[model samples]
Target: MKHYPVGVFCDFDGTISKSDLIASIAYEFAGQAGRDLVRRIQRRELSVREGVEAIFRAIPSARLPEITSYTEQLTVVREGFDQLVSGCIQRGWLFAVVSGGLDIFVHPVVQAYRSEIEVFCNHLDASGEYLSIEWDVTCDDLCDGGCGLCKPTVLRRFKPDNDVQVVIGDGVTDLKAAKEADYVFARDSLLRVCREQGIACTPFESLAEVIPTLEQEVSL
Candidate 1:
């Protein structure tokens, strides 16, 4: 085993949480319209930002509080999240939660680890008739647009020269980030996409599985 600095970029929606938060919110509040939009996103017919915006737009701005409350109730942090964070800290590895989800929901769920890890995500505005997304990050020249927070951009920004870049994700949004990483821990759709793309990666169902794989590689 060799020792080197490693940067871990993890997805939030389906990876850290037990389920996809945005999709859940959309289905619960936005109704059938939301389901259709989500399907379009899955099919790559619509950009992620477009699908998310369309879904939230269908829900009136007045329901923001209800949406937030619902999000909190629905959020269940996946097992081994804390351990993954701790492993990164102990080994002096850089760890970031790079989510395409909105801040309103992403914040509340990851509040416990706020001070420990860096988080990059989009913001939601409920000042108008419907919810609108505000982006702090956009796709770079290396990538085509669609990603709201742009995980690959964040991975490039945080991963230093000579350091190994590891990406962990479970959805379509994680695909681009996986391409940019030196190592990828993928599950579900992301795993399928990676295999299809012929990108070498480790398949994992839990963050716990990721920890030992990383530790073993870095000799930590």
Candidate 2:
């Protein structure tokens, strides 16, 4: 058994939640045009920031609140999330959500987790049903990684003294952080990226799969 100092940073949308809440909102609220833009972004034909801005711009203002409310009602936690989170807390592991998704969509999940986790995500500005994003311009301009919220930089700032960093995620935006982390648990796009890039990572289908390994590491 081996013990290592640990700090955990997790991606929110698809990693902790069963599906990508922000994407669901985009397709539902932004309609066809917005979905098309997102597809382009996913294919790398458009930058994430540009694509997100364009999609939001195409959506009618009245749909924002509806989307927000609908997302709060519809988002589902990934199976075994609460157990994993509770286990990490009990082990005294520092936990944080490092998401490129917007705060409006991520908030409900955070509330569900209560004071158990801290979040770093993009903020959305809404007046009634209209919505706009408040980009973390100060952080973005300094880091310049093209993420809606730069997860790696946030993790660095949040745990400057941490000796062992673990990043868990399921998307392309997670690549940078995976590179920086001491250990990584990857799935979906992030897993593919790790494979292609030859980055060492443990692959898992869900957070449930991650917990046992984490418990073992902490116990050691």
Against the reference, the lDDT scores of all candidates come to 0.85, 0.75
Number of the top candidate by lDDT? 1
The local lDDT score (0 to 100) that residue 176 gets in candidate 2 is 78
Identify the runs in model 1 with alpha carbons over 4 angstroms from their true place.
Answer: 1-4, 218-220
lDDT of 2 by residue, 1-220 (tens): 1232567888888988767876777788778887887788778787667777776766666776787788788777787677777766787666778887777777777776657666777887665345677775224444655666777777667556566788999888788789888789998988988999999999887577776886676443
**Model 1, span 1-220: residue lDDT tens:** 2333888889999999888999998899988888899899999999888888888778889999998888888888888888898888777777788999889878886788788778899888999988888986898888888786788888777655427888999999899999999899999999999999999889887788887887687543
Q: Could you tell me how far off, in angstroms, the CA of residue 43 lies in candidate 1 after the best superposition?
A: 0.6
As a whole number from 0 to 100, the lDDT of residue 167 in candidate 1 is: 92
Top-TM-score structure, candidate number: 1
What residue pairs clash in candidate 1, if any at all?
none
Model 1 / residue 73 / CA error / Å: 0.9
Q: What is the TM-score of candidate 1?
A: 0.93
